[model samples]
Target: MSDAGPKGRTGRRDEAAFAITPPQIVGPFYPIRERPDLATNLARPMGSAAEAQGQLIYVRGRVLTPSGKPVPHALIEIWQANAAGKYRHPSDMNPAPVDPNFKGFARLTADASGCYSFRTIKPGRYPTAEGEIRPPHIHLTVEGRFDRLVTQLYFAGEAENLADRWLNAAPHPDRLIVNLQEPPSHLEKHAMVADFDIILASG
Candidate 1:
């Protein structure tokens, strides 16, 4: 049988569209400990009296193939510093106070439609080793059957983004920046929301 289908119909042997998500440094601080229920929420502990400090924000999106098909059951891991720009880890000596209620790490599994969401505080910018200010960003690690990607998601309209070494080095800096918008009517009144879809290369 010929590979091409009659007319314009898609054939069974049609190639899958793919766009590999660019990789980035995993950074020095990945969480060593794992929580039993990391996928549900990151805002507060099980019974913490106080909510997580800083501006509340909801980060959500889908995992999709380059063809625009959702990749269900994908695992996404995220970690970032608290609103004060200090991570909870001992290695972060940024001199910013860390919020005791903020865990700074979360794991999420994409649903059947490749959708996932998590609540977290807006991360604060911190200084890099060279004394340059690194823009506020969330580190993400996505794992799928075909490939794994490590990248960071930066907020839009940050002045520091212009000088961020890692962001400026990316081949497509626009893809890494996410815009924060007002939450939908169904969500909390004061929360902001950001959608960041991750596209992976086909296996």
Candidate 2:
């Protein structure tokens, strides 16, 4: 029973050997419940007549461990404002109209490849209490086997991203941004796509 299993020549632990995705603030608006069926498709909720009004997009990514191994069965939850910049929560007192067809929340499980996808409308910018307009983003929480992480995903190339209080405060802002690109040929022509990968600290 030796304390030192694998150490550097100096017999000290190497902290730099491990680098995990940093956690971000969960904010104040997590949904109380998860409607799996309705959340899967924000554009068309279950038994909803009106179509969600906004650019239809696919948000997808993988959940991995610090060792780059896929984390299957991880729970990923996401919530965002509607295209009108109105959240479906009481705390959002903004006058903007909410999209009846949009649930603004989703809960998905990662597949064997650690991949998850959600079809939803692109969120709009909203003004904060400080009179500053917050950029369009999605609140995300990932529950893995060994760890749980909370973070926000921002749209790449958004000018407003630079002014986002939370994003600006993040030590690694680039990691929080997702690249918006054209969807695969199999998808509809109007659907856009963004990928955001999450890496947990623990293996």
Candidate 3:
């Protein structure tokens, strides 16, 4: 019901707890437990392709063009690391318990003001090949009638942003960075406010 805001001060848990009733999505992309060791359990979800259930990371933002106008009806897709910093991909080898019910993928269609919100979790930091560590970030896929884009959003003030070899090593930092804003005093303690405006090409 609550979570620490972007500043991590604590209000409500900044995530969605799987309950019998909640707004759904293309969800259950990972598992919460291992069914039988060595099987690599697939615990995403066991229903008709329902709306997903992400971990409740409050991703509320406006999608705007370089001119600073919101793009209505923008389709946004996201993929992020599990709580343990491990991806569901075959390559991730962090050795953390992956949630079998999490699919790691979600989709949202933005509103008239180019605003969108996603309920996910604060992803964990993880390591990449060549011994390079990566900061906490979220991958975004955006599409509109006129433009389409794919990018990532990195936490603004994370120590990992400075220390991690991957972020610093990026050829173009603008392509994969996001600013985490402090929530209003009312929500200052409830949920984080990550303001990311999707940069789209000229229509």
Report the number of the highest-TM-score candidate: 1
Residue-by-residue lDDT tens digits, candidate 1, 1-203: 65465333563333334455666788877877655346556777566678888889999988988767888888898899889888777677788887888878878788888888888889999986678888899999888778788999999999999988788888888889999999999988899999988888761
List the candidate 2 regions with Cα displacement exceeding 4 Å.
Answer: 1-19, 33-39
Per-residue error (Å), model 3, residue 76: 0.7
TM-score (C-alpha, index-matched) for candidate 1? 0.88
* Model 3 residue 135 CA deviation in Å: 0.4
Question: Residue 29: error of model 1 in Å?
Answer: 1.4
Write model 2 residue lDDT over 1-203, tens digit each, in one string.
56554564554445433346667787766776555452568777777898799999998878887656789989888888999999888778789997878878877788888888888889999987678898999898898888889888889888999888789898888888888899899998999999887888873
Clashes of each: 0, 0, 33
Q: For model 1, what is the alpha-carbon lDDT of residue 164? A: 84
Residue range with the least summed lDDT across 10 consecutive positions in model 1? 6-15
1-203 per-residue lDDT for model 3 (tens digits) = 44365335552332222111111122222323333121111123344154223333466777776545678988876777866777776656778666665555556688898888765666777776666667777776678778776666777777778775445555555545666555677552544666666657542
